[model samples]
Target: MKTEEVLQHVTTPLVNPAFAPVVPRFTDREYLNIVYRTDEAALRAVVPEPLEIEEPLVRFEVMKMGDVSGYGPYTESGQAIPVTFDGERGEYLHAMYLDNFPATASGREVSAYPKTIGSPSLFADNGALVGTLDYGSQRVATATMGYKHHVLDLAEAAAQITVPTFMLKFVPGYDGAPRVAELVRTEITDVVVKQAWAGPARLQLFEHVLAPLADLPVREIVSASHILTDLTLAPVKPVHDYLKGVRS
Candidate 1:
């Protein structure tokens, strides 16, 4: 499908404002954060068997423009280490993309999340890693990875999510080896907090958001990442696991 057509088709109901707004830490940040950590794990039961865990270590930030509630971005920064999935070990690299950049210290893109701090690897190796640490601009994250953190209200639908999503997925090979595939993701949008005691400010996801990906034609949210030769992050030196792949 044409890129413009796809985008237009999906953004019919979705709207955005000019300014990048911040999620109110008072109104919902703390409460939502608690519920998410507690409820997020339950989603695994719904995913297919082969997919393993659906939610990785990801951060979702929310923002507002005009009257529209959902207008923001997601910067996925994490790594996939060698793991025995279905009794096999492989690695995976993960990242996320949307129309807008999350409201951050400077409205940075997901790709530029690592620069927020001095961290390196986003995904830590629970056991074995595919390659090693990346100290080069062309580092394809053979082992670990990292991205940015977005603040979300933690309600049902906080930040509307969409595709053209980029991910570096590693999987176990036939002979207990590792293979990589770019897995796409389903588009998602944020919904308002279910509780009324909360505030009037709420993001209505699924119903108000565009893209139908719950039941029908499943969405394959992935985009192959390419290394840019001209751009260099500078100071490509290997750092410790804890030191890399994390943001404040």
Candidate 2:
């Protein structure tokens, strides 16, 4: 194929391409987020400088997506730390574990999402909403919450979506060297909150060689929330281009 023809190919072309498309819209997404108070020093060690942490907090989420536009159904769970970029409150994604391979590739390349392959699940059983993550046969994290014990205000729950989400975009060079690195920020807007809930919950993190959730070491379970919503994942914007600054 000619160089000009290669530039016009989309969907990754099943071979080699610069980037791929990941425009997925989720419906009836079962989301459970657990906020925990972690050690300030530990949080600081992971979160890069220039992003301040008003409170030493981290949020872990497990989501079961019903129908993804191109990709079929899949489950994902990950952790993020609350931070402030340029005085704006947001969450920086520390790690993401997913089950689908296509979504993983598109997420990391297109949006620079810190995605990795793992076995994660979200379900409701015995009047409780449960989420679990496992690397191989070893369980890494488990979260359980009272099923819709208390109804949450839709507006209040939706407000959280307005906060920008941040992640690192790092592309290594061909020789395994660092090629591109940047801080990317994205937002989820026009959220239609079908239902929301809040109640007492518990989270447990275990140590595993591959998927290590216990590294963060949750000091206390601050709060937990269950939000059922339909939302669109918008395009991301690079707030800090590390390569540009270095090249200059």
Candidate 3:
């Protein structure tokens, strides 16, 4: 390819990209979010600088993508910590595990999402809504909630999902030095809340060497919600450049 063609390439492989260059839209994107308090020290350790913590709360979420625009159906599970950046409240995405390669690649490469390959699933088991994450053969996390016990306010559920999400984008150079290091932010703009509910819930995190979600132990289950919506993820924009004003 010519130099001009290379400059115009959006993603890797040049000839055939891993995923199409389109903002993903979801139809009936279901979410099982369990917000709980954790150790303050653990939150301090992982939550990067320039971001402040207020209550040491973490949201464990499992998302079931019913239909997507570019990538097909997939399930995802991850952890996000509530934090403040420049005095604004937002959630810092800690880790995300999904079962789809295109979604994973696009998330990490294009948007700098902390995504990796794992086995995560969400389904109704009898009367309970269950979400689980597994690494290889061992189960890492499991969350169960009473199905549709109480109707949740539409505005409340919409507020929770609309919060801005912060992520650390770190890419190393060929010589093992940092290439791209920045804090990026994004939020869902076109969200149509289809249904939402609240209920009693419980979560369990097991010890795993690779997916060490148990590092931030769950102290107390504060709240739980089951929400279904159709939304589109906005493109990410960098908020802070870590390498700025540095001497080489």
Compared with the true structure, the alpha-carbon lDDT of candidate 1 equals 0.24
Candidate 3: tens digits of C-alpha lDDT, residues 1-248 = 78997998778787888888788889999999999999999899999999999998999999999799999999999999999999899999999999999899999988888999999999999999999999999999999999999999999999999999999998999999898899999998899998999999999999999999999999999999999999998989999999998828
List ranges where model 3 is wrong by over 4 Å. Answer: none
Clashes of 2: 0
- Residue 238 lDDT in model 1? 15
Worst ten in a row by lDDT for model 2: 13-22
Q: Global lDDT for candidate 3?
A: 0.95
Let me know the TM-score candidate 2 reaches against the reference structure: 0.93
- Deviation in angstroms for 219 in model 1? 22
Clashing pairs in 2: none
Best by lDDT: 3
Please, what are the lDDT tens digits per residue for candidate 2 over residues 1-248? 78887776655654754333547787877789999998888888889867889998899999898887777889999998989999888999999999998888788877878999999999899999999999888899999999999999999888755578998988898988678888989988657889999999999999887786787888999988899888888888989877776663
Ranking of all candidate structures by their lDDT, best first: 3, 2, 1
TM-score of 1: 0.19
Give the range of the ten consecutive residues with the poorest summed lDDT in model 3: 8-17
- Cα deviation in Å at residue 54, candidate 2? 1.2
TM-score of 3: 0.97
Model 1 scores worst on lDDT over the 10 consecutive residues at: 223-232
lDDT of each: 0.24, 0.86, 0.95
